[model samples]
Target: MIELSEVMLEMKDIIKDFPGVRALDHVNLKAYKGEVLALVGENGAGKSTLMKVLSGVHPASTHEGEIYIKGERKKFANTKEAESAGVAIIHQELNLIPGMSVAENIFLDRQYTNGPSINWGKLYNETEKVLARLNIYDIEPTDLIKDLTVGKQQMIEIAKALSLNAEILVLDEPTSALTDSEVDELFRVINELKEQGVCMVFISHKMEEIEQIADRVAVLRDGKSIGDITKIEDITLDGIITRMVGDEVDEMFPKEKFERGEKTLEVRDLEVDHPLREGEKKVKGVSFEAYKGEILGIAGLMGSGRTELVSGIFGAYPDDTHGEVYIRGDKVEINSPEEAVEHGIGLIPEDRKEIGLLLTRNVVDNVSAASLSKFSTMGVMNEQEERKNTREYVDQLSIKTPSIDANVATLSGGNQQKVVIGKWLTTDPDILILDEPTRGIDVGAKVEIHRLMNKLVEQGVTVIMISSELPEVLGMSDRVLVMCEGEAVATLDRAEATKEKVMEYASGNF
Candidate 1:
């Protein structure tokens, strides 16, 4: 017995369409004051679309719906209007100016002022108060946004929302970048906000988080609401997943064992210098071998240089890096990413939003970005050839989009990741390196990516994966390479790589 009068936000019969696709079809959602409503869905399941509608990123006219806030119907033409109505959204990709200080970002565009002058003292004081409220003490008001860690940046985003006096907060995949302890701290803050009667719509793929934080859950599937909202107590993980995916996901990671072949990629005495800091080494003398027909997992705590090591091998690092890399028993000098591509190497970067896709471009452009030479004639792109190539990958990767011309920004996180993979596959690399391939994607897409990796191995593409999720590493890899403090500490076979063992090595227990 829930009461609708107590609801802080209500969306009824929402319908949104984009070109040839119906992104949301008659979706209904509600969020009560002092409660966290979890949104669960598969890739392209309309969860993001629904949130965009609520935030006014997709205005009322673009989406068919009735939006009620505090029992009063209202229409927002833009995000500013939504903010004026006490709504704020923090996207999966953070929105913070790197050069600005923490306090400046928190009070951006609405800085405290006195007669045409910014009130610096008041801003710092208010920023400190907000930090204290969140139990964060290390971050200074003057600290640059770029200097803080991802977790701290997320806190700043929350603080910014609070500064705007947001009563209804929408968080999309907030915990994807946080560590275990940071996640606990964030959960504490969320609980505090709940007590303050701030309605929150939490979107995440992590089941444990949903169970711990959400008061109610809504499931979306294929651009439609699957059913009515339900309590967390009434559903199991499988049950929620079934509703979101419209089928039973018997196994989250469908890994198949394959016999290891001859060594394909071997790195010895690898050292990557820090790009920004002089005389600082990000990766130091790291050595490992990835065999063909197998997935070699790189396990590490964040900032342990796992990404740097792989980037060095893929020639994404600067020329100052010192490394010895061999492919199929032949040493190669990879001074640039182009050279790496020429030597049958491909890398999917860790920060997908920054390094992976062209947000303004279409799916076809992003998928064919890595192999544009094939579609070029006399230094000019051949549109017909480009479309043919893009269509091939669009079908092969099962990318769900209205058309290849649709902007990549319109797709969900999972589908965006698939586009990244498709871009790399176009290069036809023998050795593929994936850094956090499934970081922010949904569980269904995670399994699909894992299956795709296995399929690639069957086709003899060597796969080296770096992952923070211990379960994924243990479940998908034939061997795990544990890195700690910029060095490879231990290499264990799949049979020997338990979570405890991997964590021990990753944490420098040995």
Candidate 2:
């Protein structure tokens, strides 16, 4: 527990606003030395906006806020000024040059030099010291960033912050992409930092993670502080969630039962080679089937070949993939995404920004991108028809945006995800493959998406999902397939699939 006298960072009376939105309204936060303070909220609850205010991404003049470190007020004009003031934030998306070496990325833009030349030996040696301070021994200073795992890259991000001698650290969804074992390692390092009197502000949408690591919890709702920061032991998970969402969340999963219909999609002995590695197989001899009017869930840990299996089936990697896919009792070949789409298959990829979204485009363009043929005549698009169709979907999905003309990037994480789903739905596919559909989204959005899935299944559309969250799989799936090491090890019915059972299969424990 953190003592009251040891407050290391405090953000008081923060009020930030945009053109039509008051993102943060007089919000306050405090973090004490040697403790983890968790900031919990639904999407669009001003959590990211508040962090931007603190990190100088919004700037002091832009947001009305006062920040203090050790009881001394500080004004930061930019991120460099914030870093100079002993503040550092590791964003949700890692910001590192993948082609560079670890040492080079760690000391990016600020290199050790002798006159006009970089000091290679001194730079690597200094990087080694920073890594050693964090008890990281497996990664060498000269290793390429792309060669390392996601977890190792996260550690390097933390090391870079520590290299700047940052006293207050802010982590934004640090474990969102990590494996279970990797999350454990990250928690271990977090504990180590706590012992060294480094104050941390953790922002996450995960409830289990809050229970595991948070000493105190602060909830934000509709750009306002829900209440005072409360001790973790004094509140229930439901209580925190209620504070965040401003309502009783009686049913987070809301799974519905539907009659299973005929077999809609089937795959046999699917194999996909790793995109980069020469001889390594990502998905090896995997087979699965999805039935109409049912949601089939694929469960596994990260890197357990869950994403690769679905991608292979969706024809994301055509030349390197070999599989026999059958849709509606007839064997079909899917050599590309276009072929899969034409065969009534839709895939919502895991990485929404990289593979799913057009950040710079508007909602109408993004939604109609896959099905422009319906709104086009003589090779020219009908703009009014496109807008009307997009508006219909925007209302159907309850996507929050000022206008259909607003850039997709302006919406929150949840809304952006809905846009991706809307894009695929325009194609009117019979079989939907959703890879991490609810990943990194807030509780409200997750429930909404689940409800939409229920609606789809009731209409006889086949739904197949791949998720790392075990509880989601157990709650929503009629049948769950557990994968481990590029193989489908077990298939369990919803009645028999518990978290423990799924984890056992996912870890290859038999």
The ten-residue window of minimal lDDT in model 1 covers: 1-10
Clashes of 1: 0
Cα distance off (Å), candidate 2, residue 328: 1.5
Across residues 116-184, which tens digit of lDDT does each residue of candidate 2 receive?
999999999999999988899999989999999999999999999999999899999999989888999
Badly placed stretches (over 4 Å) of model 2 are 113-121, 276-280
TM-score of each prediction: 0.91, 0.96
lDDT of 1 by residue, 1-510 (tens): 333348899999999999777888888988899889999888678888888899899988888889999888989999999998999998878999999999999998878999899999999999999888777898999999999888889999998998888999999999998987788878998988887788999999988789899988999988888888999889988899888877799888788888889999999999999889999889989988999999999999988889989888878775867878899999989988999999999999888778999999999899889898878888999988788877888888788877999999988888899999999999999999999999888888888899999999999999999998889999999999999989999999999999999988888888
Supply candidate 2's per-residue lDDT for 100. 99
In each prediction, how many residue pairs overlap at the backbone (N, C-alpha, C within less than 3 A)?
Answer: 0, 0
Off by over 4 Å in 1: 1-5, 360-364, 372-387, 405-409
Candidate 2 lDDT? 0.91
- Model 2 misses residue 92 by how many Å? 1.5
lDDT of each: 0.89, 0.91
